[model samples]
Target chain A: MLLLQSALVQSALVQAALGALPAARPTWNLALPGQLLGALGPDLLLAGGAVLLLLVAVARPESDRHQRAVGWASLGLVGLTIVAVVAYASRGALATEGPIAVDTFRWAVDIVVLIGTGCTIALSMESNPLDGILTAESHVLVLFSAAGMLLLAAARDLILVFLGIELMSVAVYILSGLDRRSERSAEAALKYFLLGAFSTGFLLYGIALVYGATGSTNLATIGEHVARYSLMYNPMLVAGVALLLIGFSFKVAAVPFHMWAPDVYEGAPTPITAFMAAAVKVAAFAAFLRIWLDAFPTVAYQWHNAIWLLAVLTMLVGNVVALRQRNLKRMLAYSSIAHAGYLLVTVVVANSLGASAFLFYLVAYTLATMGAFAVVIALGEPGERNQEIADYAGLWTVEPWLAAAMAVFMMALLGFPIAGGMGFFAKWYVIDAAIHAPHPQTVLAVILVLASVISCGYYLGVVLTMFMKPRPANAPAVRPVPTGTFLVIYLSAFTLLLFGVLPNGFVQLAHDSVPISMVGAPARAPVASAASR
Target chain B: MYPLFYSFCFYLFGLIAIASALAFVTRRSPVAAALWLVNVLFCLAALYVMLDAPFIAAVQVLVYAGAIMVVFLFVVMLLNLGLPGELADARGLLAKILAGLAGIVLLAKIMSSRTAVPIESLMLRPDSLATVARIQGAVAPVAQPLFTEYLIAFEVTSILLLVAAVGAVLIGRRRAAAVEGVGAG
Candidate 1:
């Protein structure tokens, strides 16, 4: 009766009274859970091996000779992490309230990021000699950064997400400026570092405010609390959520926060650019999608319009600006920005359907974008010269296989019905998801189509430049494609084409990969009641 | 009488913190600016103490005022940027206007929210500081969960540190490479 009467007292007083109780202490689980370790196994292996790789570099003499070997080692690390990911994912999703999420969504994104990293490594090994950017540790930095991406993919707690973002961004800042002789590279690094730090500040502040509002850092707990309290209109939570979205927008290069992408992409080595464009975007979107779709779904109605405006503006501005770029890297940068816009559409849909569509599109986008960059690496010469659209003219005559491969990637990007192979299916699923959303983003669906149509102006421009225009007399001779770069381009084109033709199996896998948090009434009944106890 | 004294201390620290922050930013000499920033940090720590978050207050004094201020002073000395004269400020009119507007908006929001909102009815426990520092001692409450529930974050933070270290190495290695290039040429 006294305990019952205590419940009616002030909560702060109740908390203090409970703290004073001499009941058997609820023992803290200091021993890490087996499921937690299994879930984290891939990230641990990648990070631990990256440290070993750095140590190896520290021991060895600084020489260009070690670069290719280090690059291969990094590729091997990615391959191993992928194996671990698949092994764990096969056991099915682990329902975790821990900092790390172990589910199909994380496994899927991990695979995509690893594939992108592998291609980047292979391309880097091939091209670093030509560019005189043969820092042996650059490959190890890529490995560390990919490990960070894996962490980002799995992070369920806001603190883990912050650590992941920092680990990812710092390695990339160094990688961007690896070609120390180039002033452009220095400018790219400085700009990226400054802007990245700024966005991180926003993210941390958002996390702090959200923690303040919800009294929890775990995404599931936050979601549960938000729903139970009907805190969708809470000013502090609203501002925090907005800032978090803005931070993710900057990372994914959505229209307003995309100023750094073009310069960073153009100035970084092409392979690193591909990693940034493909893997970085994939990881950031994975966390963003999971965080919002899981933790902030209760407030989806509030944020839908903001994301809608972002998607609309991102799509319009990205394509319109991409249309005018003559430089191929800058063009690809804007194209990636445009792709970021399309991805934001999946976010706007805000359901398991959107999540599945996002997974499917990421796979398609990763393959084509990395392949196109590999082609760019093959075409461009030392000092990153001869990369203009005009330089790509009559590429068909010089290297028909390379030109054909480049065209496949370009058409894939454009989402042409037959020629694009997998890209059309990817776009089809996204539009389907948008139309079928709880809010039915019919207008956004239409905007997505119009944006895709605008994108054709640039994607097809590259293909036409390669096939239709006459080769300039002063066009730099296409370099002999290295074995690693060739392998990446060939495999990417082949896989994308195959999937494009028969996407049913892949689509099923993607449909299954939606984060488990979105599958039902997330986290069961009201958590506020549980918190009160 | 006690409540009045407590609030008086709060206001004293708060006003001083704001004034020192302004001074920190406006000072022409970099060393003077850095010292003023240290003063601002000390005021913040004092306010934190009044708020009953002594751990945070200690951290504020030790990390920000002690360690970080030293680093700032070192940088100011190394760059010889302490000279007040000829250090052209980049403060434009637009920037000044924006800053003033931002300060006014912040103040207005604080004042209005305090008056209008029934903040106590929000169900947020007003005394979270109790749970923050109970347990076996002052440090145990924080250290316990940090090593137990938040252990994974702690482990991941090490990777962040490693990445930072690798970045510093890359920068150093690049400088070496550049010098070698110059010598060879």
Candidate 2:
């Protein structure tokens, strides 16, 4: 095989490239292979997996056989991804001046994305006639998007950030439209693509302006240039920051730019929406945090208040709009937008606590969202989509356990204190970051809390419908449940409870991931200019 | 040696890009718009060559021009959009006003901010038109910081692209099969 040979060749090339570097001297802790793989391994493996899955799909004409192959192979590929992560993790953190920073922070976030993708794949394994479209591509796209998110989490260069954003968006564009059986999926895809391309132009223009202003795309280099040249608060620099904020805000689905969220989320399959909600948000926040952490620290005084305004607006708009949605999926979509706003408070803080809060909240949110979507996929019937809240009018009779699991997920998402729940802790961490931020980020924190209270209305609405409302006598009997759906649901629920109870494990993990002090790089001031003072 | 060849390639592509961009804006028909978009993609690929980002350029061509644009053209043809009427009637007052305002603002900003970027401290400086690799080598010191500190992040970017390709093909293939089944029926 060509596939095996290509893998070997690629690995050899990577090894050669690493060896050829002038500073190829092996650091005591990190083997060059680990260091290189930490950066490129996920991409290579996903690429290989994509090829393998494609080949397997084409090679096997039998649909059943293909589905089986897709399920196990996806599991295998995710397993390999875990191996790569472990390999990179074992090598520990490396301090380099590379365009991407690699350390525990990135590795931790990678695990959450990878796990979420794995769960989505598992939830997708049922025998819908639509599975033909939903098959291996969903897994591959999730992997690709995850890869983009991982790169974004660690990117230290504006160009790399742009590339990562495209990488994530392109895959998502196709996946969102994967269910061609419905017209809405195609509509969602088209809308997302148009908006995504427009935002990309804004981002590219911003990068050009920033490059023109600072003559660099490397965040650290730009920081140095600003410090050395005293160009902080320069008009061009300020304009560049504003444009960058607009572009990223759109990606994260912040207010005003969030028109695409409810439609796209409602249009795409529930599992895919879960991926967008959890993995995409985490990665976007990761990149957003990195940019603000490295480049905007000095000018935080100037940019801080502006971001605070956006944060408040996004939170308020997201939560308030979510209250009226009749569609459960659409409601969650609005809630997610609101959640993005809530997380924005921490990002606005842009400190050690903020970083940790983001990491912790990301994990908690991913678990809760993935768990909720898993239930949706289980309840949903073929050809008949389940967007209506009225559809769940049940005595808790058809599926009592399912209803209970759904209730827990809803409560967690609302950040309600369900006794040792991760949701409560997740919100607390974000609020804590906002409260203690070196700057006066508390006002944003107040908005975050108020928006969360508004969130309780919709989240509780889902619970009331699932439990109290009665199913009609003429309702069709629920279909036999698949093994995969059950597996995903229980796994998500277990983790949600586990993390909630043993909050410190995840808290410590989050604490360890904050990019406070990097190796081989000096602490970059916010907006100190090279020519300043 | 390589830089010379690469520069020629870049210019060739750059010309194509500019031409396509013009076509994209000028074209009245949706089909023409799609086609011009493809051309713009090709030009972008060429620009990538000059920029020394061969991988990205290749993706720009393959994914955008090759795969994505084909989809766009397919949809445009399928929709059977009729020819457009005269622009005089089509242009609403709001549209004309917005267009004028945007153009004026853009022109004003560009004219006001026309100062050239200063690069006196840069060890090697390439003009905007140089090959990407030349730009890379000229900015080798800049490359040092990117690779030395951000190397891990760089490799992860490659994985992201691979995933995008796989995701696209897989998603496309399913609908493709369904479309075929319907056609046969």
Provide fnat values for all models in the order shown.
Answer: 0.88, 0.50
What residue pairs clash in candidate 1, if any at all?
Answer: A421-A500, A422-A500
Q: DockQ for the candidate 2 complex?
A: 0.34
Q: Return the TM-score for each candidate structure.
A: 0.84, 0.77
Can you tell me the CAPRI class of model 1? medium
Model 2 chain A: which ten-residue window has the lowest total lDDT?
A522-531
Model 1 spans with C-alpha error above 4 angstroms: A1-32, A520-533, B1-27, B39-54, B66-135
Model 1 agreement with the true structure over A62-103: per-residue lDDT tens digits:
667788778788888888988787766655545545777766
TM-score of chain B of 1: 0.66
lDDT of candidate 2 over A1-533, digit per residue (tens): 77445545643443342212233333322235465554666656765676677567556554655665676688778878867875665555455455666656677677777777777777665633443453544565666666677667667779888888888888889878877687888889888988888888788888888888899888877877877887787889888888898898889999878888889998887778888988888888888888887776776668777778778988898889889988878888998998898788887878877777887788778888887887777777765365577777782889887887788788888887753268888898788777766666667777788888898888888889878888877766666567877877776666666567555445655665656233333322211211242
RMSD of each: 12.5, 10.5
Predicted structure with the largest TM-score when compared to the true one: 1
